[model samples]
Target: MAKLQQTLDDVRSIELDNAFYVEDGTWIESLTVASNTEFDPETVLEEISGVSLFYSSKIPTASEELEIRRLTILANESYPFILSLILRQEAIPNRIVLQNDVFEIVATTRDWDQFRSMADEVQETLGEFELLSVTQNEEPGEPLDSGRLTEVLVSKLTSDQLEVLETAYNHGYFDVPRETSETDLADELDITQSTINERLRTAERTLLELIYGPRE
Candidate 1:
């Protein structure tokens, strides 16, 4: 087994948010202690204001891998909604920060009691690691990525097809209400549904190809 690395030192406290527990079907604390720690999302961004965070934890068992995959899909599905909250200024602090060691986390917050409760839950779930403290900080950066991912996503599409994807994503067509229709989109793009579908299929296939590499 891979040994746990040096204990996390710089973490000021474990952080949590209302979304933390809800986004995934299971409670965040329900996750194995072996895999997670308390993280304050805001203070973390302050510590590494410019860097993107990446983290991974061991899958001690098969069930845990399934859980992680579910959690990842849930997070991805919820990202645009989460981001809209920040963009509309409906939610406090826009991002959460975590260390690559998978031992520390920084989260955005507005309520102290809720945050405290989250910390308690995390410390309980992620045994051994301790929650030290929470502190406030200014300097929230732009909520959206600099379009690197979007650019990459769009690059796979023709200019006209890219426009459709952006329009769908922005209008939340991919979201729950299905605000936009194929007819509406076809009218706007001056294309038939069959053509639109083909372009989108090409775009999606290319995007996946880029992300996962060509098939074997």
Candidate 2:
């Protein structure tokens, strides 16, 4: 508990996120660094000796289709123990920043055997390891995109609209051949087809606005 409390106070760290092997003896990784000081992302890349940055970008990177690598660097980071508390409960600690030099990378491991294998492999690049904590989930996949969903759903859609949209989505109403139709939805809700169509269109438009912002 003493070691844990000390870590909670002040720490600096680099996180190698979502790393996985792409091929024989090679790994694809997205690395993140946080410290008490400001450092240029470009310059930091230059400082590294041998690793190839397939691509790099600052946090809050929008869709690649909308924007590429940003010019600004994530500077003056205060992300330590505090960030751990604030982050979503689903997120597991992958790294613990020790003093100023330690990389704690959390990856989605299905089981302990897999985690041990990964830790052994990661130790080669990171240069040693101290197993701090491991978080197991009954579901072994990434969490939902709740950030965007929450913002759009809460502010824009009405209760009726949300119910309709949820049903349509769950039933694959938007599928290529359309898994379910307005007629089916109308029947389920005991509403007219015309009413169903109107609600769906309005809901769809609201969702679109979330991505593109309000219409011009």
Candidate 3:
């Protein structure tokens, strides 16, 4: 069994956006974290023998205080603690975060066995484990990789269509109560109401086809 490592210290939180097993035990991971003190993950990573930095960005708060940082690292060690076994399952990790002292990992697998195996591994190595919630995705039998979600979504939707959809989503247009309407979207996008409707309709169709598989 693989042991869990603190991996990082002086960190408020860490969110693993995407990760992939390259070869051997090496893995590539992208993450965003918030820290209160002066803690550079790269320095700690440098301490490890087989670690390389691909990209890094630091974004501060409105007051110019360094609060959040994003990094993509390629390392033989699985950064936090979960990757020891997480990499084995090939599950699409949703959000892997370290809050306080506990690690919360949400991921999607093709079947129940895969999820169960990962959960089992966590319990064995991490000592403490919690099974929060497991529910089927909206599109049954349709498995979408987190990496491909963005690439495919962008390729299918034009910029204008994407902009409108993003605006609607940000303003809660898709809420059950319908927070915003076509007229509201048109005003926000500075486009005609008819155009707003058309863009949204087309975008929705393309998105649905991608998810549910094109209509026969």
Q: Cα deviation in Å at residue 25, candidate 3?
A: 7.1
The alpha-carbon lDDT assigned to residue 198 of candidate 1 equals 76
Which residue pairs show collisions in model 3? none
Q: Could you give me the TM-score of model 3 versus the true structure?
A: 0.52
Model 1, poorest ten-residue lDDT window?
64-73
Model 2: residues >4 Å from true position, as ranges? 1-145
Candidate ranking (lDDT, best to worst)? 3, 2, 1
Error of 2 at 126 (Å): 20
Greater-lDDT candidate between 1 and 2 = 2
lDDT of 1 at 123: 50
lDDT of 3 by residue, 93-195 (tens): 6656767767776677778998888888878876778888888985433222343344456567787887787788768999999998889989987999999
Candidate 2 residue lDDT tens string, 17-107: 3344344434454434333334444554444433344555543321221111222222222223222231323334443232344443444
Going through the candidates in the order shown, the clash numbers are 11, 4, 0
Best candidate, lDDT = 3
At residue 127, candidate 2 shows an lDDT of 63
